[model samples]
Target: MASGTVLRSHAGGYLVYEPELDTVFQCAARGRLKKERVSIFTGDRVELDELDSEQNTAVITTMLERENLLSRPPLANVDQVIIVQAVHQPEWNPLLTDRYIVHFQLELSPALPVLCFNKCDLAEESELEALRSIYEPLGYFVIFVSAVTGRGIDDLARTLANKVSVFAGQSGVGKSTLLNCIEKDLQLKTGVMDHEFGVGRHTTTSSELYRLSFEHFPEIRASQTASWVGDTPGFNLLELKHPQPTEVVWQFPEILRLAQDCKFLNCLHLVENDCNVLNNIDEISLGRYNSYAAIVSDAQMEYSRRQVTSQKVEATVKKVGGRGGKEIHVPRLSTKYRAVSRRRERQGQYEEIDTDDDSIDDSLDATEDDTFQDGIVGQENLD
Candidate 1:
């Protein structure tokens, strides 16, 4: 068996790169892996079998455990995420940028998040300064680069050295263009912004990991370190998840710091009295605060939704023995409407009571019986 890293995944199979051999092989996964529902994603370390050197093909038999994984781009074991945005053309959106930051911060805990603004040549110096002023102080490593002018490319190259970095941002923000500029050999496709829509057309349709060598950047040539960069398809809509209402503050570093002095330990900083975050609101940027507020509101709604869903599930479903003696969740019937088993009826504990008119209890029992039958059908389908 041979060990390699998955560089890309497609409908056909995957492209696995073996570091020791310095070769890439077109590989297909083993049948057992598919049967087990083991997903093979880019950047995953996998063991290979059935190697064919002449055909440059192999079969992936095993996948090693990943250090981390990002669901949006379907990447594993990423060291850092560079959130790229354009200062012009497509335009800069602070709220959207913050959402990405918070999302990665929550998903990739302890992994660094770098902010890169592309198309600097189109933006005024003051505009650039304003961006730096907003995010630099918040401990974000910010870089202003123009792929057209080659500005800050050296700095960006140096930061990416020896790490598996992912380039993520809005489409048409010049992610592909900047990467092409960094390495002419890349030649990744670039797109133009739509004049009417004010958004860039999608150029990168999938995520692929590319090796960045020192030869690409003269400044880092002496270092002899190579980096791997995953160019992911750009997206406009980002949905933040997992963070609870109170935990939302943790994603905003500045607010989290100020929240320490709040009067209530669980204060959400909206309108709570003696809230230090609200008291010192001026210290936080209006844009950042607005993003925080929006995210917190969303988180609160999600939390309420989850609470209601869990309660509903608890009320409607119950654990019961399955065919193979395994416990499974099955639809539960209300005690009031439950049908007495034949064994219970056989005991003759109570006499059968007959009513002249149709009773509400009988109707309810019939409805519940139908519902129970439907639930059984759903469970069987799931099985």
Candidate 2:
């Protein structure tokens, strides 16, 4: 079989598409991909060989290089990310937008992010105008489209032509409605607008790409053809681990502009002395700054936790001297592992101690219940 992108993944396996033939193949891996800890996500281009047409099976032999990837939904080779937000329903969550923007900027090619304000007709004039004014000036193209009335639907349709776009936003933001409007033929299931909450119930349960067709173009008046659009299920809030401050700042155009004047080269941007970020912080969106601050704080806490954890790992590795032949050095923490030894003294069920510098930290402070310290090792990679 030829190379194709993985559109959907399931317990059975993946559905890969060959654009050349416009055919979909059901493929599975010979070995457990997750066992190796490399999650083969959707939007990944892979090489496949047909196992048996009768069995509807194929083997995924190779995965193609990806332009960008994300851990949460685990997708790859995405062309652009559509950030769907509403003018009124569920109100505006700039913090959520920050989360999306932060994740997108970390991508390899600075993937294009388009903000679509759905339910435009429902929005008050001031609300609609305010959103356009804020995001449009910041380099992001803001489109005001009403999925119900078809207001600006032509422009929205033009934007989505011949592209792979992911519709992402909080629950009830009209992602499905917008898709239904764009590809009217699909008549994709959509929930009614909630009068009480002013939001729609999430009708989509899983992420799936749909082929959109237009019979007659309003401008060209030519024959209709099919275009691809991917719709993702709505999420309440994005769960993001602490990311690097440099990466976080880079995501926000406004913050990055202000960060240039920061006092220190490595300013954390939180209560730093003579910090330009802090001084003009109010000028920027409060929600955006808070999101950045939260991630930075998480990173700082994770760092502190790692220091404590490394000390323990170093001591354990020294005691075991395992055959891994790895040198255990716990920086940011004292070489002495006495603190961990003392802490574990009361626990009788402690198994073999791990002292590898890169070993994951298991230590957690009871005083700070939700606080997690960042260490050299990640949540999954730790031995």
TM-score for each of the candidates: 0.78, 0.68
Candidate 1 structure, TM-score to reference: 0.78
The numbered model that scores best in TM-score is 1
Candidate 1 C-alpha lDDT tens digits along 125-220: 999999999999988999999988889998898888888999988777888898887778888988878878777666677788998865766767
Cα deviation in Å at residue 334, candidate 1?
Answer: 38
Q: Write the residue-wise lDDT of candidate 2 on 1-383 in tens digits.
A: 57877777644567777767667777775443332333566777788765555665667766766656654434565667788887767677776676676555444234558888887878788988777777787788778888778887787777777666688776678888888776677677877666785555666655666655654345522433435667775543324433444445655668877887776876777878788888897788776678778766655665567678863211111223347785432212212212446655545223213211322212211111011111111322110
Regions of model 1 farther than 4 Å from truth: 236-238, 311-383
Task: Please report, in order, the local distance difference test score of every candidate based on alpha carbons.
Answer: 0.75, 0.61
How displaced is residue 277 in candidate 2, in Å? 3.1
Per-prediction backbone clash count: 0, 7
Please state the error at residue 326 of candidate 2 in Å: 37
Best by lDDT: 1
